[model samples]
Target: MTATKADRTPYLPQEPDLAAPLRLFCFHHAGGSASVFSGWQRALGDAVSVVPVQLPGRERRFDEPRIRHLPELVNALDAQLDPWLRQPFVTYGHSLGGLVSYALTRQRAAAGRSIPERLMVGAFPAPHRRHALVDADRLDDEEFARRLVDLGGISPTLRAYPDWLRAAASLARDDLALGLNHGIEAFEPLPCPVDVFTGDRDPLMRENDIDEWAQHTRASFSIQRVPGGHFFPWDSPALFLELLGSAIAHTGTRRASVA
Candidate 1:
């Protein structure tokens, strides 16, 4: 039997209206939590309900063991998301979350299941072209933290809190391991539309790699660039929200035509 929403509550700490016509599932970057997308509901307003996916070993699920492998992580998420696929929804992921979103979509397609109306991938290259910018998983604690700081994933304020830094480093290592170790053996084009978001100054995602995402989807594909680094959504929420809102509108229109 499939699990109910309550049973899957741990995976999705922020619950939205199950009956909401349009659901926007947001996934966070490495070393991040659902809290990263907190308050997005208010930002996007009622037309779309924002539901943030909370991975294990972070935030409220801190006691749970972290998932270090891509396949394992995607399987766990697929199970939890199965029941929630009843309505029109979109997947919005940043960095590592983008990779997870794409993998999960492929998993669903492999099972002949419903896919997202739109796949919004932010700051992540297409799977086939994913090359590690930094091998955080192999780095020592201090070096890992330094890499995070350099990437804008760690802030100066976070550096003062040793305990928080250690915890973030641990989560980052596991997430980075999943990303670095996962290899793209084959390329399968998706049926759903894809929107790729990048930052003008993001050094990790090369322009050529971002453009290559077009080859992964037979459906409509587009790219938008904002004025920041890898963490542009955090630095420029207004611009990010504008782009997201436009994508949601486009998806909504598609849903109407299908109905």
Candidate 2:
């Protein structure tokens, strides 16, 4: 299937066997682009193909308006992602993206399509476990910006530019709205397993919150704490790659069915 601007701009590095046993789709945090996963192709190598999901209003699609609600974004992705599901896909989502990943998995199951082979949640707490603390949508611009800085998810260069600052704020606001408004309607665990990754120094995610993710999945639940803060993937890619490899290695057997 042909790719589109509305759909995430996927980058494939050194084509792996197109029919490889496993494909990994990565969703970046808010104000982040698919480029975040560019290093992953090399890190993952031949065992798996890495495809990064690019949400609208960012990177190549800068002119598009940001989507502000969870359901709308999820629905948009559900349609765009349908043709891309080449079987036995696994999803890895960080921060705001984690919620989207979880919802997408549920939607896929509800639609009677092949469910992801595994779900990898990173940076964020389980949807149900997030504390009713700071709501980015409700925060003033200054407060919101501070929250982003505190989370250390946005880059310093982007934070310095006015245009990028506004764009980042808008994207952050919309994403926060989407994440906060996500619905939890009787979510059943996937038939496949799930792995959660969190940073030991991440101020936003507590260890217990990560542990709570176990309830959302009936499959074997595991959590690993990396060295860096919330943006561990950027700070320590080597360690991140190793952790990711371990997660993928644990799912060695060929999946029987995508569904």
Candidate 3:
């Protein structure tokens, strides 16, 4: 059966910019919406186009069913993003989104498709590393909420709204299951350069674990520690953006040097 036009729209909606030289596909953390990257275009200016990837069951896609498995999620994204792959693009994913970006890049490479110019991951460790935090999926609601709060995953606004909290918690559990339980048996290093960013104080991440990402990338690998906790991107948008801009700039410089 043919999918309808509504089904064809990319999960994240953005004004089309065919002329932009580079595209930065931004992926959000667990239970996060594209709104997490709202106003990034204005912040980034015209040198690069900022495109946020919206996962299902959140914000505008609230009606869609949530996907719990990493493979399933990235497969769906691969289909939606195939057309956009012709352009020079990079991916920036935070936490769970980082895994999604990395997995998607590998999936594309395995299929001999166009891969991103760069991969920027934040607040996530290498795929082979086991998560050190307690399993929130196994916790009772009260404990789950408290754990999320401790991880800075839950906000005060979410606490005030029972309906929102329930929905958010449900999505978060699905993501946590995928991130923590799923293990990759065999993996190949990616061809593109990788830049990893992590919060200095994020409890879920460790310097050694973050450094392990270097082994998964055959190209240049770099890691930077920014200030704040797990939600550092939200805590310090200016610093995060500065780091992001520098990464993008470095990619451009390298490409220019090679040319």
The candidate that achieves the highest TM-score relative to the unseen native structure: 1
Number of clashing pairs per prediction, in order: 0, 0, 0
Q: Higher-lDDT candidate among 1 and 3? A: 1
lDDT (tens digit, per residue) of candidate 2 on 30-92: 777788888787888777878788887777777777787777877888877766664557889
Task: State residue 75's C-alpha deviation in candidate 2, in Å.
Answer: 1.9
**lDDT string, candidate 3, 38-132, tens digits:** 87788777888898888887777888888888888878889987777667788899998888898899888888877888999999888788765
Error of 1 at 24 (Å): 0.6
lDDT against the true structure, each candidate: 0.83, 0.74, 0.80
RMSD of 3: 3.8
Q: Which residue ranges in model 3 land beyond 4 Å of their true spot?
A: 1-8, 253-259
Q: Could you tell me which residue pairs clash in candidate 1?
A: none
Model 3 lDDT at residue 171: 78
Off by over 4 Å in 1: 1-7, 253-259
